[model samples]
Target: MRRLVGVLVAVGLALGVVSAGPASAAIDSSGSAVILPPDQDPFYVPPADYGSRPNGTVLRSREITALAYVMPIPVHAYQVLYKSVDGHGAPVAEAATVLVPYTSWTGPGTRPLVSYQIADDSLSTRCQPSYTLRVGIGSPTGVGSYEVSMSYQALLRGYAIVYADYEGPHSQFAAGPQAAHGVLDGMRAVLHHAPAGLDPNTKITLWGYSGGGLATTWAAEQQGSYAPELNVVGAAAGGVPAELGAMLRHNNGNLGAGLALLGVIGLARAYPESGVYGILNDRGRALFATNEDACTLDVAVLHPFDRIENYTTIADPIDSPQARFLIDTNNPGQATPRMPYYNYEALQDEFVPAALADGLLKDYCADGGTVKKVRIPFSGHITGEVQGGPGALQFLADRVAGKPVTSDC
Candidate 1:
């Protein structure tokens, strides 16, 4: 890997450039961010036997300082690359940042785990939690910063936190099964990471919001079938994009139109058989390619209020049979989670319709899952986090205390 990076650097020097255009900027790291060599870049070159390894098998681990943006925190941080599966059921390697709080558990049987998936809405390695959690490193969308701040809150409560990339090596951003596999395998990696001193049987809570909420919900729904042994106590997700079709339809012509476009790009990357690219016009292709390395802010700034229909050659790209099939396959709450759930949605959300989230809670209830649903009024997408976080934390606290959850469903 060093040799490969050296050659690339040498070539870049020959060409009088340090980084290679937008691809280099895609990860959105600072000038001081530790640059990995090409061969060693986990995002670029995964292990040859990636899918062959057992799920959750830790391929590599490196200790690093946990940071809240640029400031270091008193936590034991380990960056781990673990075995996971992709949308195609192929083996893939995923990365996550595990943080063991310096404080001890004063009120619990054991320090519970929080698989805190962040809203890393990007198809770039640089946006991965493991990368952005380092001091001086930042994601273009600032989502990483927000995630670290939230993780710090969990650290204060004596919970070990694992921030999984979830997007996998291919940066399959919105693929449900792929994200679930990455998150589950990430938990496996952290639990077995001896140095973290966590019990294998420790109870866990899956917590996330927005894009992370989508991944968290999927992980919760798949945990019974995929990682049945995990002692998950509850899942707390807010601002969930439960129905992709509804989200896309709502995002169209709204300020969040860029996210809708990016969702299509992500879906295409995850399920190429859907043939999204094949249906695209030249303008559509260019727009899609331009967003290949974009983060949240970039996407919104570049294509705010843009409609998905404007980019495709077909009358309605989202309703195409291939797209519909993939969307249905990825929608969450198909299976019942073995544990209780705390689902909250902003009634005024412009990105994901509140009705869709309500439907997800209803679907989970229908599947015999215990669900406590909350609707935060007067809150939109971004502000919903502030309004809903305290309630979610309290719910998670109750679970950590081994108290029985009172179901709203």
Candidate 2:
């Protein structure tokens, strides 16, 4: 969210990098992309009982109703990172919107909603990633980032797109409710600034796959309460790695063990009670020094999971007391949602455990939450990107049409 540090974002836009022809207009003035204060535009507040929030905004329910409106889009897109509280009132980072108009129009701007896309580690520029290589990792087609596809989908539906690096630049894998705060705050920046080429009424539909699924679930659980102004219609989380605890135990000695490492790092971040941070002595600290900064989730997947084998075990990183607490927090998908939610799981997934998926489904059904459970037959975790995404779109469209949603889902 900070001014994308001029880290020379080593990755250059490749040949086929396409920004869908501008279907919108631009801002009427010059701008710093200046420094802004946190909570200048309050959205989040604590407690189920109503209370006036950050900007003296009154909350009727848990949801923060009216969104700050921004119009007259800016010529160039600009990004800023600031801190704000999540639905649970925890301080977090937010990435502001940068509107780049692709069209010319003078008529009163239509307020379009934004669909958010959570990418993997490709978000950081400090080390300069190979865009081509990163795109390939996200999509084997070697064609484009998912946002390219997601943007087209949003535009077709008459909504703008907002790509979120919910993991922040550091890529916190699954911190749960804390992640979405930034995503929603960014939506606020878009609404308040209404950068020249962007829409003023950009509502939101949180969407993601695999690693991105964490953001979708986080944002959905926070909506109707955190940033009610975003008017989040719904959310779709594909390849839901619902339970991190199961993922580690099940993935032991398997191809998916790498995810366990990512979970350790993330959970340790969100729940300090997990005891991962202090367990490691100077030796354990050294492993993180070399590994944490350079390692991506994918690269870590190639490991030995035997009790004392390799990085997979995260062997003896924390004390027994702290280790138990961290392991206990492994279940993430159990969130009691405040909005419509759908999650897809690959029955044969080597990345996310099936038991976790099944357990989450049972909890969701029992909680009386809105859900669509799609079990991918004979598929791994990524199939949902191709299959579940369209289903989610249909679900969102139905909600927008004010049509009844079937409980059969």
lDDT for each residue of candidate 1 in 1-409, tens digit (9 for 90 to 100): 4565466556534532222334342222244556452224654455777667799998888887766755777888888888888877888877888889777777657779999989977767666677667633333335777766765677788899999989986677788999999999999999999888899899899999999999999999899899999999999999899889888888888878878887888888899888788888888899878767656555654566788878888888778886797798788867877889998889888787888888888787787889998998998987888788888888987898888888788
Total backbone collisions, model 1 = 1
The 10-residue segment of model 1 with minimum total lDDT is 19-28
Off by over 4 Å in 1: 1-33, 37-44, 135-137
Candidate 2: Cα lDDT at 70: 22
Candidates' lDDT values, in order?
A: 0.79, 0.49
Give a tens-digit lDDT track for model 2, residues 1-409. Answer: 1233111121211322221121122221233232112123232223343223342122211111111112222223444344545434655444433333454433233535554544453212211111212222222211224334444554455555555435553445566655666566656655555343454454456777766676677667666566776666667777766665555666656655545554665556556665566665564455545445323322242333532124323454333556566554434543666567777777777677656756766776677777777777877666646766677777766655555655423
Off by over 4 Å in 2: 1-78, 86-92, 96-112, 119-151, 196-202, 270-273, 281-283, 295-298, 301-324, 327-330, 333-335
Task: In angstroms, give how far residue 45 of model 2 lies from its true place.
Answer: 24
The 10-residue segment with the lowest total lDDT in model 2: 60-69
Q: Cα lDDT of model 1 overall?
A: 0.79
